[model samples]
Target: MSELAVPAPSRHQLALMIWLAVFPTLTVLNLLLGGWLGDLPVVLRTFVLATIAVPIVVYGIVPRLHRLRARVLRGPHG
Candidate 1:
């Protein structure tokens, strides 16, 4: 069987992809936690919260999954 390919990158393309993927959510989160700073319309807040949930789920879940994967990979002998 073949191994999965590691992700490859061009610096500019990678940077652009990351910013595009994450920027709007970050912006919304800032507003969610603020009053004057976040004085966004209600509709915008709804969209932001929905978008922000992705990273929130990843943040909450990824570390636990990472640790579990590490433990399994390392086995009991480690």
Candidate 2:
């Protein structure tokens, strides 16, 4: 099997990537589901948000962000 060697993002970049993925996801989820979540206890609310957010961020957003970063780094020629 062949593998593409992509360099890893630095700590700051990784942090930015995570924030970029997480912030809007949480915001929108909260906006859409706030009333339902608001009735729950704080712990349960946090738990629910984390459960739903993690997968969406990890599987959906992060990969797209990575591809975008790669494309940007590659510039017009690539």
Candidate 3:
């Protein structure tokens, strides 16, 4: 039996998806953690944020977005 292949997102699409996941995540994290993160130096703060954000975006958000995109592309019947 044949299966429908969903093409991978293009560079632009991937960028947008990553941004869409990353932006809100970082924003909320900053809002929640700013008082604590504020004491850290600029580079350290950025590193800490990146470390926290990367896994959440990669393991959590991106997969959901990819699934959503596939569902959209497949339409309601799919």
- Give the candidates in order of TM-score, highest first: 3, 2, 1
Tell me the deviation in Å of residue 73 in model 3. Answer: 0.2
Query: How much does candidate 1 score in TM-score?
Result: 0.35
Worst 10 residues of 3 by lDDT: 1-10
RMSD, every candidate, angstroms: 10.3, 2.6, 1.5
Tens-digit lDDT track of model 3 for 1-60 = 454668999999999999999999999999999999999999999999999999999999
Q: What is the lDDT of residue 11 in candidate 2?
A: 88
TM-score for all models, in order of appearance: 0.35, 0.90, 0.93
Pick by lDDT: 1 or 3, better one: 3
Task: Please state the error at residue 16 of candidate 1 in Å.
Answer: 1.0
Q: Name the regions of candidate 1 deviating beyond 4 angstroms.
A: 1-7, 36-78
Clashing pairs in 1: none
Shift in Å, residue 76, candidate 3? 0.5
